[model samples]
Target: MGDAHVDSEVRFEVQGRLGVIVLDRPRVINALSHEMVNRIHAQLVAWADDDAIERVALTGAGERGLCAGGDVVVLYEDATSGDGSETASFLADEYRLDAYIARYPKPYVSLMDGIVLGGGVGLSAHAAHRLVTERSRVGMPETQIGFVTDVGGTWLLGRAPGELGVHAGLTGTLLGPGEAIALGFADVLVPSQRLPELLERLETEDVASVLGALAEAAPDAPLLDERPWIDAVYDADDIAVILERLDELDSDAARDAATALRGRSPSALAVTLRAIRIARGFERLEDALAQEYRVCRRLHAAPDFAEGVRAQVVDKDKTPRWHPATVAELDPAWLDGVFEVGDDELRFDIGPGTSGIITGEHDDGDEGARE
Candidate 1:
């Protein structure tokens, strides 16, 4: 309704009754920084009470994507060069923002146009209306950096049909628009060419009416057809058992999945499996976020996280010599402390409203964006 306020990396504009947020750091694929998280949360809090704003929409600048994820290089530096308190604080704020998005009172629309992964998924997937295009490539690829999926990812992935969550979580598989919608990460399939029109119409028209006019049928999701083999191979909680089953299965997808899992940090894979399983029982997205926070704190202190980040991000080397080397070598007892509630447990204090907004102070540290 007034002049646009561009906060360096994140830009906000009120167009008529619609509030638009544009993640503006195209160089980093609009990766979320600590400052960006705080700014977004504060804006959401303000708009939750603004009568003029009937709906909110989130998108990204450039053609790359909405967000690549949280800036992991900063996280790498925090883990390797400093005490991990900064990383912990950043995650706490990030998670709080994600939880807020899940329960936002107004209609929250996300344009999942391009490479949405990790923190990107957290931002968009939890929205009330998640729109994906043919170019959309989404997933939670945290295991690649020896980190378990957070931002309420386990809650969404755990509820995915028949071990598909387990397969995707363990392999860090990227899903196309079709697979994303089929897996419940997205809703309508709108062409990239029509996104601008859709946005303009959303400013004045009802969300469902605008979508019904613009949405198209998504392409066939091949992953949905592979459920039999995927469910058979990934049905077990034990990574070793899953791997053995994969080797015994005849499907090439299963073999590829096993190979992918083998290359990941064994501890991360184990803990990810545990987190997803435990998340299946949780009723709230905040519960999964809290659990992930505990696991994340433990991961920040572990050696594999640093090594994984170094190999993947710092050194550009694909090889990471994990602590245990393989799933069989990982001691089952070692994962116990990772899920335990600690003194720094994440809390979502309900604010004085029906909007379910979290009221608290957040760390405003600006970490650079990560993919």
Candidate 2:
């Protein structure tokens, strides 16, 4: 184990047979910076080859949760800067990291305790053991900021049962622990207070045995009851038809969901829906991530991305004036542009031993935590 400061910058330690990763940015709820991602990637690559490390455990430094997501302020800067080199590098490396996690061979346990957000989801959701606490708040609220979900959001969210994934994407909804489990985002629930004891046990006990001893029963998910309506309304591929369907529902849940959808950037809604739909057919995490890269590249230059960031992050006004403010006004060609990967398209350098991935990041300061 290292000193407190050393641990804060993403400390990697071999505690007995366990490989421990502590995300140490408590001040910003353990947001993923570029440097932190690099450190994590380097260590993870090393650990994959080390026979002494029997299992891996990831957790945040503070009580706030695992991670907020990638650095959005940096993303905002990159988006508006005209030069997209930084943004491109971040997305490519981040996506590769996500793919590596999906394909990692060992026992990977993620303690998704608090606010596991967008970038945070990339870190935890693909683990062999994804644990959530009652205090956990998870989602991809990128739509509100005029960005579609990235970090393999389409792959994960698209695979959700029924139309729950589409609803989650369109509304930028944050799911609590129960909802998360119901949505298949988490594999187990362990009370936050018991996490330290679980970590202590991981030093000697296997991940499954420790979880079986400490995990609690998850509460019922209220969203499950609304699935009928969620499915009916969100099934439409066209955003306008989807909204129209929502408007027709007699249930208050439908009305509320409609209102939430209306408040988001129209372009983001359309693009997110398309991305999720496309992801439904993807055979690999890397494929979905590559598509997300194409979309993120196009979105960077789009007016709405910068404006959405300004309203939500910079001004804190929460009032973005989306061009093509309504779904009906959105040009199909513009939406199609997101799928066209340029010469600089992302490609994962995956391998048997090396898994070929790097670190991913999202901003902790943003309103939405990653799902």
Candidate 3:
């Protein structure tokens, strides 16, 4: 590989003519920092204006991640003093970047190699071309962290194959390459070793061409494909029914999923599932994002999110006390505020509505990595 490079708090480089961005902090599994967010935004905008740049590739700096998600330690710390005010600010800007990448102009590629979860899911999932490797391990996982899946996941999850979105949101389970692709969370899957060679080729090849080439060499199936589950259950509109089918998996995979779901906040799961359903058939991305913002504001204003994070991450208690513990106890009115935006609440200014800024970026070039 040519190894053309740029380094800062994170990293921005070029492989031949391709713009390559690496999430540089490896210590906490490449947890995203605010500075990295600002830099990535700046670099991407700069790249957008450069005529010489044909494509861009985004990756992580360490062995374990394309990115694990946002800095949980930071989130936990921010909420420690009974001030969830900071949490709102972090999410607002983070979602803005997620929207930015989703709408970026050039070929934006995400090499989802390993540990792609939560906010990590946001950074990559919306890209036009997502490449997963044999080592790829992806998930939404925000339910476990006391947050609903932010970073535009509510919209994506709302639309995943069949009932898969509800399944993922409720359980916070991990999805391997095949499962990710099957769920429509990823587009292509290449082997781990061929990555560097592929990046070199990306400088000259368009996305369609690299996919054509990679397809000839790669296998047909994902590592842990979820076609069976998706076909049988993912399409079900009802969340409770999905659980019944999952209980019938009769395999280790199903058992693992069931166990993970048992530990999550049921109220969060229920609200999340409904939010996804309402978000469906949405004509624009902002419509969906605004809906998510409503849910988040309620999360902080209420007791679940902050307290959930407290017990699970901050206090390390592993025993979150979820009020209205059952789905049946939840009220539809809880989300009305989210849908009906207020003066202090967050709202996106997507095209045809406000700034007409780009919100859905498609990766036209096989820029870096594909799922």
Candidate 4:
């Protein structure tokens, strides 16, 4: 085993042929910072070129989870005090990292052990080998913070079977391993107790062989049973209509979903709905990321982004006063602007063994407990 490169928040090391990265901030559930993102990106780029490192694996420290999400508290401060430039830079770099992960050449394995949400999903879900444990609780809970899902969430969600992605995004529901795999966010379920052995085997064996031997059959996903209602209710692009359909269906799950959507930022819900629809038509993950970047850039200037974070994180009030309190009050023109491509857009250097590049010469640029 090689000596670890230890950042305060993240750590990297090489063990035999496996390069291991650990999210080390267990106190905050390993919430990611901009520095953490950059460090991980740089390390991944380096490891991609290292012939000695045949595979890379990511894990979070502590018992709670791999990552809770991004450090939204910092974002709240930046959005309120700065000119949105700082937030824009963070998004740019974060999205670029996500694009790179999606295109990584070497086997990238994510141990989706516990609470993986928002940016956590970005890190793990895009990997070539995504291993979820029975303890895994995965989701794109961006709507809870008055933010539309990013970090390639729209791409993942857009490609989900039926309307599972739409329901998950709009409601910000946390999914168990079964639901996560059923929704296509995860690949296999490995028992939590067996993870150590699995990692040990990775030091000598290929990812496919180790995972194939240790992976267990996932538990039943109740969400799968609800697909008929989920597809029926969330099939439309309009949030208002979806809510109406949820109410009209009159099932417990449908009503519950409706209640969940009602509490989130109206603008976030609307934008998420549209983003997923558009992402469904995209040919590549990069395209969805570029679209999400546009929507997220616009969202930084919106009142709900700050307000939602205030209520959810700063105050713990759980009552955000959305600028447009209702979906009906949302301005169609403003929504259009949210998806419009601006001077700064996210672009990737598309090819094997390449990382993403941000284009348009703009300024540089979380998850659940805090997504």
Candidate 5:
């Protein structure tokens, strides 16, 4: 099932009772495209209904790990294309797929082996069985790209224990398997060497048995000790306040965190803080994604996403000329405008004859109150 222009980058096949999804884009570390999202979503739906398929296992093609993220270069093109409708469509579809993975009934196992981030997190974090190997490095690095964590990043990151989510959201820090597990972003940690054997055994064995047998003991999370520091510095609701707090601390970690925020797009930092704060209240993952959709609808038009992409990806220059220059100069209303949208929202089609879930409210029209 390839898209019109290209062969299928995603390989979906059945091996005995196991339904497997192999992301086959080693060139870009398997960064997801809109076509990949649709194909993967369709396959998931097909496998979900197939009684012969007992479980699902997803992994990347090469050693680079699952996925780097979404194709932001394409996103940048579409977002700034003057007609951002395509970008919006892509976000809605991507989020729908993410929500589906969140609620997927069967054993949805994601092998997060290496360099998993942004879109990568969306694909694997919500699954029932999120498997990571020692080589895995995962995070939501959207802040650097002039975007908040879309693909239900708000829901996934917001729910992490304490203010760890805040630290991750603002800084775009990459975490190892141990750190990921400590942050609740990953489940079992399997050794990189054992992954091949584990996959072989998985074809014939139950997911639980295979994981239980091969899952390696995770090392001590270096960040776990920094929880108090993270909670202290990231406690503020405002990014400015958080930065001020970080600057006040004398520790090198605090200095590093502050420097990291200084380098990101100021607009993205503000929008990300607000998104995560509001997301903390949503009960359903769909609700959080909907809010993210509202932000994304207007996000592309902002000067930062394009400029950020140009400096980081297109031009090879590390300097991004972010509008307003600093967080204090950024208008609150601009960030507010990102969240304002009409009826155009994300809708999740679970299956045939099954209705899609609209964002913001349930069919009964009552909002699922956030916790």
Candidate 6:
């Protein structure tokens, strides 16, 4: 009923009772550009008022479905020429939408399929039901792109159990469905081949039926099965320790991860680790997002973000001249500066509202006693 006729990067459909939103930029692995964010917000608002749209189930087009994240080239261009206002503006709007999704009414179902990374994780992680498939290859590789995982990732990852949060924070390594679900980043694991049939069933079933079928869906990856790497390196309290361990390991994956870290902007990595650590005990999704916003604003002004992005994306060269030799060489004062507010901010005086529970509400702010 509302502006569904116009064209956009996203497509909206009603499969019986379920309102399906598909991310359609298959050219970029369905990456979420700024225009896509606005389209998503508009459709969500439209769906909120439409009585026919009983529930929303979101996914991407093509066989490799779901989303990756914001196009970095767009962000880099926006941040060019000492005018980062556009990029900052994009972060503010995107973060607000993320907080909204985390606190939305009705059932929010996300098919966490395909390359669900940076911006993609922002969309799915906050939903009422998170369904990962064999295709899901999830991570927040913002550090590599000279960006930190904003959009409430710091808060969400902070709330993740143990040092795994910090592990994801620093290295920006992606995880498979098995690893992601084991770490509680995803809720259910379904085979990719069966997802279409399940979505069809969900279009007509009651909420109970939808969830039961999802629960009954076979887990394509067994997360709880032994994953030796996460427990070893990810278990560290800080990035320094994690890097030290990574340096020690002689395995190809370990060496690759360490080499990748060496190539990233050292300042970005340092700030990212601190952001995740400080994100502990955030009371609401907004609070966590506020902190992330602060870091994003300061990140570009620092040395690493631009250098990292230029080396990786713009220069078409794999080499980045990271300032520090290792995580240890990162200056303490510079690292602390990210959390400081020197005017710019993303915040609100939002009143208490009940949305569905996320992975965070499982605790009673008892992270300290356990950690």
TM-score of each candidate structure, all chains considered together: 0.94, 0.93, 0.82, 0.95, 0.92, 0.85
**How are the candidates ranked when ordered by TM-score, highest leading?**
4, 1, 2, 5, 6, 3
**lDDT (CA) for every model shown?**
0.86, 0.82, 0.70, 0.87, 0.81, 0.71
Residue pairs clashing, model 1:
1-14, 71-369, 71-370
Pitting candidate 1 against candidate 3, the one with the higher TM-score is: 1
Q: What does candidate 1's lDDT look like per residue over 181-257, in tens digits? A: 98889998999999989888888887889998999988899899999888877889899988899889877787788
**Off by more than 4 A, model 3:** 1-8, 216-259, 328-332, 335-339, 345-371
Residue-level error in angstroms, candidate 3, position 314: 3.6
Give candidate 6's whole-model lDDT. Answer: 0.71
Cα lDDT for residue 206, candidate 6: 60
Extract clashing residue pairs from model 4: 69-366, 69-367, 70-366, 70-367, 89-364, 89-365, 90-365, 366-371, 367-371, 368-371
Off by over 4 Å in 5: 1-6, 349-371
Q: How displaced is residue 267 in candidate 3, in Å?
A: 2.5
Range of the 10 consecutive residues with the lowest summed lDDT in candidate 5: 362-371
TM-score (C-alpha) between model 1 and the true structure:
0.94
Q: Report residue 368 deviation for candidate 1 (angstroms).
A: 30
Give the best candidate by TM-score: 4
Error of 2 at 14 (Å): 2.8
Q: Write the per-residue lDDT of candidate 4 for residues 27-55, one digit (tens) a residue.
A: 98899899999999999989878889888
In angstroms, the error of model 3 at 317 is 4.0
lDDT by residue (tens digit), candidate 2, 221-332: 8888889888887889998999899888888888988899898888889889999999999877777888899988788778888899899889989888998788889999
Q: Worst 10-residue stretch by lDDT in candidate 1?
A: 362-371
| Candidate number with the higher TM-score (1 or 5) | 1
